[model samples]
Target: MIKGAITGLGKMGISHAAILGAHPEVEMVAVCDASSLVLNAFNKFSSVKTYTDFEKMVESEKPEFVVIATPTKYHYPMVKYALERGVHVFCEKPFTLTASQGEELTELANQKGLVNQVGFHNHFIGTFRELKRLLSQNVLGEVFHFSGESYGPVVTKEKGGTWRSNPEEGGGCLYDYASHVINLIQEIIGRPEKIDGALLKSFYSKGVEDAVYSLLRLDNGLSGTLLVNWSDETYRKMSTSLTVQGKNGKIICDATEVKIYLKKAVPSEKLEKGWTIKYITDLALPVGFYLRGEEYSAQIDYFVDCISNGRKSEYNTFEQAAYTDKVIEMIVNHSKTN
Candidate 1:
């Protein structure tokens, strides 16, 4: 079994712990968190070791892989430490506070030849995977425009401030929310080479934005719009979707399903003219364990498989995530000018 450890027992971190604990290929060795309440719970129930200090846990456990789900500001140091120790790492996104930090870590990981994956779980979602496959086959010939959007009820009526309310801590709709959309667009569609316009708006939040609007141009010269808001009460939870328009057809995709429109028949895919819908059940591959979503387990599975098999993954790599961070910075800079 591949020995693994985790740090930060927040929502995402806890989820990772459960998933990794259940993984047939993984033997969870230890966990670390700053909260005594969380550590106490682990100590009471789990046989795994717990620590308040990350360095101590890593040094003592000597896990082959570690999952870091701490806040964005802490990602740089933790990821660097893991890489230097020759430990594979799976980190939660958005990658880092700055693009430069992401670049440096990416270089170090490459030099160390360690498996590194960012928790951009959307890439593992079946519908999006199908969307990428269809695009690769040129099913939507001569793609013209696209849009990426996400909305959630995270800060509907924000009063108190947490780390999420601070920009330096990777708060704000742009970093916390829109970064997902930006990464999807960068990887699946094309890299955003320029940020034409941007808007960071605050509704109930004091220090950070609750919404982000931006115009982007891809390296292929494809232009698109990005609209994300975490203040919307319409969505009980986060809802993200992507739309692509092309001469042949259009595609609308989300985590649950993908709706396709074809001007003419694509008999090979059994997708006729007009509209056709494919559900996640039909597209998602079965996994040994299930959690909040299959994509979560699927991404962890991929990370563990890559490390165990000594294979490098192209998906959700640090290099790709760093480019996403660069786009975030571009949007921020453009927002200032506007």
Candidate 2:
């Protein structure tokens, strides 16, 4: 069985650890956290070895791979360490502080032939998955543009001191919230050929942007806009919406379903084409324990399958993330110039 370890014990860390511990074909071997309380609590529930230092944990456990849910600042060092040690790695995003680090990690992982994946779990979501399929089927005839947003209240007027509030650590809403939609945009239409415009602003906190707005032009002549807000009090939970306009009809995808609107009447096995909605039950992969989605579990399962088969994931790889990070670098650099 492949041996797995986890670094970090925060909410996301716990989620990764849970998946590792429960994965049918893998052995959860070790865990690491700087907090004594965190380690002590995890120790009580798990038989896996726990360590305060990641290097010590790696050396002692010699795991086949590790799932890193540490804060963004520690992402590079931990990933670098694991990759150099010939261990496969699945890391959370934003991949690193800058695109250069992403490039470095991408090169290293590719050279090592290690299965590397980034945690852009949204790609595994059913509605988006369906949206991709429909787009590929040319259901829209000729696509024109795509726009989207992801918003919630994780950071507001009352919340600012955490690591998420720090630009270098987590990069505010653009990195935390906008990254999801940006990655989805790449998946659906491919990366933007050119970024037309951008607006990054901090409405609630001085250190980080609570809102991000950008206009992009895709290679296929599609122009799009994005607005991601993390300080919005209106949302009960994070809501994501993507609308695509085409020559014949339109496609709209949300968290639960994908809706299609055709200008002319057309009939398919399941869809009447003029207007039809498809929910996620049959489209998404099944899960034993779902927290917001089966995407997390699906992502873990995909990684394990890749490890077991000695192949690479077609989605959410370090190379894909590095490409996205290059776009991020361009945006940030352009923001500075303008």
On lDDT, the leading prediction is 1
Instruction: Give the runs in model 2 whose Cα sits over 4 Å from its true position.
Output: 265-270
| Tens-digit per-residue lDDT, 69-151, candidate 1 | 99888999999999999999999999999999999999999999999999999999999999999999888889999999999
Minimal lDDT window, size 10, model 1: 155-164
Stretches of candidate 1 off by over 4 Å are none
Q: Every model's Cα RMSD, please?
A: 0.8, 1.5
Per-residue lDDT over 1-338 for candidate 2, one digit per residue giving the tens place of the 0 to 100 score: 99999998888888988877778888999999989998998789769889999988989999999999888999999999999999999999889888889989999999999999999998888888888888888878788878888989877675558788888787688888888888889877768767788889888787888888999887677899988898887998788888998887999998788889988655553556488888887788886656657999989989999999998779899988877777776666667788
Clashing residue pairs in candidate 1 are: none
TM-score, predicted candidate 2 vs. hidden true structure: 0.96
Candidate 2's displacement at residue 100, Å, is: 1.7
lDDT of 1: 0.94
Cα TM-score per model? 0.99, 0.96
Each model's total of backbone clashes: 0, 0
Cα misplacement distance, residue 144 of candidate 2 (Å): 1.1
